[model samples]
Target chain A: MRNMLLLAQFEVKKMLFNPRGVIALAAFSLVWLLILLYPIRGASEFLISPDYKALIEGLFGPEVVSELFKWSVAELAIYWIAALYLFPLFSIFIAADQFSSDKARGTFRFLTLRASRESIFFGRFIGHMTIQTILVSLTVLATIVLAVSREATLLMPAIGSGALVIVNLVIVLLPYTALMAILSLYANSARQATIYAILIWAAMSITIAIINNYLPIISELKWILPGSQISLMINTQGLGSFAYAPVALLQTLVLLLLGRIYIKRSAI
Target chain B: MRLIECKDLSKSYGSKQALKQVDLTLDAGAPIALVGPNGAGKTTLFSLLCGYITPTTGEVSLLGHKPGDAALLGRVASLPQDATLDPNFDILTQLILFGTLQGFSKKEAKSEALRVLSLVDLAGSASQKPKSLSHGMAKRVAIAQSLIGSPEIVLLDEPTAGLDPANAKKIRELVRELSSKTTFIISSHNLDELEKLCGQVLYLELGQLTQSVSMDDSQQSQYLTLTMQQCDSEKLLNGVMELADISSIEKKQHNEFLIKHNSEEDYAIESALFTLFKQNSWQYKAILKGRTLEDKLFS
Candidate 1:
């Protein structure tokens, strides 16, 4: 267990210390700033205005207005809306090279000399998850800060919901990270791994839709893709958001198991 | 103690069989040499021993544990041919990580990394990334990583392949210094180097273990090379043959002869050869016991 943690710690160091990793982090920070400036910061006042209530009713219908009003802090609401989809997409890129480049460079041969392939695989998986967790925490903390700066009394409430938001967002990104673990095993590069993820996602959706069209009984097969729970997950608020956690957990479990099996049989 | 055991070990890539069914047992000892021509399955066998790839058939046991088993984590280390360290991290960081993984604390790992880097004469380059180092330097760093924790069994594939003469000699000296405590299985094409470093040789040909020889065994070390001053080759061979206990004689050059004899004493053959040289008025240049490793393996 100690060895596995050391491997995980080194994996994090590898991603952060590499020039490419620093560049990726810089790009993410730039995009995040743009998000904070335009949609999140710009729309903050509008979320509390009467006009905003009407716009929500017009766009999402009157029924959603009541459900949306539960979110008193505008920054947290907007952050959640943006983060639900943004994080999982960014995760694919962040985790895509978990194994591919290392395997290609033959570094695993050095690592596996002291660690097992299983430990290295899961150690890297844990490392990617830890990185995603930090990114999520930073963005969430930013949202919470923005919320409290505008209305000091919203501090306690924002902190309460921000913690919940972090947990749910991490759960949603788990399968995406795990999916990369599986793709990285076969991909020769991170770019190739991302391409494989996109191809597999599109193919999976198309194949399921085509199959479901002829056989309606198999409509539930849509859950096989990692993103199947995102749509449902985005609609829930507060404690209700925990409902789809099982689906994401199941997907992560299955994908990680598949990755482990494939890695065990693979040549380093 | 038996250090390595292989039973019906075989490996194939699709339709091409890289290693056929072969059984081998290696005991704990000084360094052993794994020698073969290209496409002779030397790397494949090394990979199996290191547990980088599973064998298609049979089993491999290293230090009483299956290759790649967690039990053998700190016990067995290997320098796989062409395998490299991560280019992103500096040499010390990677080496320290390897040490910590093998159960060293951070402080201990750092010191161990430094020790091994010094062993390869790259302790000063510990802070430099792999890309900054030349190929030979990077290769030595890779070798240094394998030496971390002073493993009981170290398998090096082509340890001196890219090294210059000075660096190669240093590595040979390092192996000699460490051989008393660590068992090394070095696979290389340099016969002369192996002949100096190894006590046993595992010779493979076309995926088969054709011969497993001791460097000091009678058949390999019993012959002598006689270099005489310019003389008639037939006359030189005839005079050498006239000596008793002469098993065979081959005229290697116009004035050189390789004589294989069944004599129990090397001095007895030398004394007789000295008399034969005087009878033919051939002044001797040099007499060397045993043939070159190249001659032993190929000739």
Candidate 2:
């Protein structure tokens, strides 16, 4: 436990303090800030609009669509979709260098001398998750503050929705971070690792689409891909929100184990 | 005591065998020099001993425990050759992290790192990023980290390979000072420096252990090399021919003689030859006892 925490501490410091980390965060914050300031600010005006209501209803279905007419529900729904889609995409770039950069520079040579291979891999995985949690939480809090400021009665639901979004975002991040960590083991450079991660995702998504069209029964093979449960996670409300939680957790553990095994078996 | 025991230890990467089966035991305190050519399994052996890679056939036990055992955390340290520092962290930050990993508290780790940085004469460079430092500076920092917590055994592969003369000398001096408490297995192509620092020599050739002898035995040889500026092959041989301590003298080259002494103490023989050379007004370079490591290993 101590070893894991120490490695995690070092990993966290590296992410927040390094120049590359700072640049990535600054860029993400700029784009995230624009979304929060522009579209999120107009949620109250849009919730009262009848045409937007039909459109929201058409997209999300009548079950959750009526809830979208409320300001808190609309902000949560928009942010949930953003978190489902955009956050995982952002996670890949942010996590691209997590393990590969260290392996490339031979830093793991020093680390393995003290910490076990499992500690290093899991510690890095948890550290990346912590950062993503903080990012998602910040955006969720911003959404809640905007909703409560408009209609104070929406505070409780906004808080409830905010928590769900945070959980969903973190679940979405688990497999993506673990996938990048695995790629880092084989990729020669951080840039190559990032590009390879994107290529793998594209390839898997394409394969899943083709399978879905030809053989819908076997389309469940899509679960093999990381973050394949994001749609199920976002579309389901309350009890259904956690439907794919176990699968995401399973994929995270499996990828993390594979990464640890690779580092252990290979020569440092 | 950190005792290193290897029993038929072998390693192969698929079809290519790196280290053949070998057995050996080494005790702590003496500085052992690992002398080998390129592709001679020097780095491979270090990796196995440091637990960077596992052996294929046998085992390596350090301090009576397997390498990389949690029990050996602060007891064993290594300076891997060609391994660069992380470019992001400053030297102090990374070194302190290493120190802490060995079980030191944060404050204690910082203090240990500062002390080691001073030992390597890089006390002022602690705040410098690894990429900002010179190659030699980076190597010294690597050495400094290995010295953390006064490890019982240190495996240094080419510790002074690329350092400047002054820095190299400092490293040699530091190793010499630490030889009393630390068991160091240093692998380097610099035989002369290795000879000066190591009390024992272990030679590897073609992934096999060819020679293992004490440096003391290397110095106790009957042969001595003499270099004189105005030395004549015949004259120098004649000059020491009748000396009781001298058995025979052969001219290796101009101004050089390989003296075979008559079982006399090395200094007595060298003293007699020095007196003879002084009488003949023969200017000389140096009279070194025994063949150098290069001559013994390579020749």
Candidate 3:
């Protein structure tokens, strides 16, 4: 247990200290600030153009105009999309290189002194999750600050929804992170694991769309893909409705289990 | 009791066998040199011993515990070949992190990190990241990391590979100083370096243990290269060969001979040869030197 904690702590420190991680976080925050303060003047104009507004209302209902008006600092924050996709991308970049790079650098043998495979795997997983939480929190706080400063009459109708959104986002992202971790353990090189992960995700996405289009018998397979589930969760909640948390939880658990099994059986 | 023992261990990757029915025993308090040419299973053996990879067949035990059995790791520390440190971290932080993982308290990790870094002569680079240091400094940092928690078994693979002559000398001296307290299995391509620090040598060739030798068992001799005068040199050679305690002789050139004699009895052989030269009224020149370990290794 102590060894696991130490491994996790080191993982966290690595992410925090890495210049690429720091720069990405900084860049995301800057973009969040721009989106929050100038949504109508800038971003919302592009998303809420006459044609888009028609499409929005046609899809969501006429009240989406008011929904657009109720966009809080949190709503303008990109973390919702960022956490769903961008955060997972960063998680891949941070972790896909974890074990393979260690092997490449010849450190995996040395690291075996500190802990066993089980501890190293779970410990790094916890550390990466911690980093994700911290990055998400920072982006959320920055968005709230920008919202409060720009909009003085802030009752923030979607504040509760925004919090739920982030929670669901994390839940959806966990499985993908676990899968990437397993890929990292199995691959001999970071590039190979990353390419494998991206290709898998792409194939799953295309398969989900194709299944959704024609297959009545296995159309439910679409929900198994985390990306499809996440899109459903986002579209459902974005229009002021709650998603099925149990389904999301179940998918997350399966991915985590698969990841653990892969890591346990992996050679390195 | 043996601190480590391996029995018919074998490992293969697909079709390439890395280790083949290898057997070895490491006794307490003895530093063993694991010497081999490139791709001769040195790293593979270390990996199996350290529990980074499981053997395809056979068994390895560390102090009576199986390798990779969590209980065995507390006493067994390994410095793998070319192990990389996290380049983003300072040496102190890197050490502290590893120490803490090995079950040291935060305060203990800090102090031990400082002490080990200094032991490796890397005190000045404590605040520097690994990327900023030279290859030799980074290697020392890796060595420093393995010394944490005073592990009983230290497995160092090519520890001195990239070091400069001075740094390599320092590391060799440190290994000699530390040998009394810890058992080391160090692998190197440099036979001279291993000869300087190891009491026992294990030579691996083609994934098999070909030879094992004890440094103490090889006797040192006083060797001489002599030039003989032309008084029928065969009679002179024949006369020299007839002396007692002369170990061997080799003809190096038309008129020169290389001679070896037990050091304690060298004087007797030299005196008898000198007497023969005077009686025969022959002329000769001789220069003597101490025998080296390399000569024995090849011999």
Standalone chain B TM-score for every prediction: 0.92, 0.92, 0.82
- Per-residue lDDT for A188-255 in model 2, tens only? 78789889988998999999999999999998999989988876665565435677888888998889
- Predicted complex 2: DockQ: 0.66
DockQ of each: 0.82, 0.66, 0.59
Q: What lDDT score is found at residue A150 in candidate 2?
A: 73
Cα lDDT of model 1 by residue, B116-157, tens digit: 999999899999988899999988998898898989999999
Per-residue accuracy of model 2 over B1-299 as CA lDDT, tens digit each? 43899999999989999899978789876799998889999999999999988999998999989977878877888898878888888999988888888889999999999999999989999999998988888899889988999988899999999999998999999999998988889999898899898888899887788888687883457878777788666777787888886667777666777777766453777777779878888888988787667666755
Clashing pairs in 1: none
Residue clash pairs of candidate 2 = none
Listed for every candidate in order, the interface RMSD values in angstroms are 1.0, 1.4, 1.8
Q: What would the per-residue lDDT of candidate 1 be over residues A1-268, giving only the tens digit for each residue?
A: 7776887888788768889788999899899988987899888778789887798789987765465567867787788889988998999899999989888888889888788889988999999899889889998898888888888999999989889999999999999999999899899999999999999998998999898999889899898889788776656777788898899999999999998899989887
Instruction: Give candidate 2 misplaced runs (Cα > 4 Å).
Output: A42-44, A56-72, A210-217, B13-15, B218-221, B241-254, B265-268
Query: Per-candidate RMSD vs. true structure?
Result: 2.0, 2.6, 4.9
When 1 and 2 are scored with TM-score, the better candidate is 1
The lDDT leader among the candidates is 1
Task: Kindly give the stretch of ten consecutive residues in candidate 2 chain B with the minimal lDDT sum.
Answer: B262-271
Instruction: Report the C-alpha displacement of residue A147, candidate 2, in angstroms.
Output: 2.5
Candidate 3 scores a C-alpha RMSD against the true structure in Å of 4.9
| Candidates 1 and 2, the one with greater DockQ | 1
List runs of model 1 lying over 4 Å from the truth: A64-66, B227-232, B252-256, B272-286
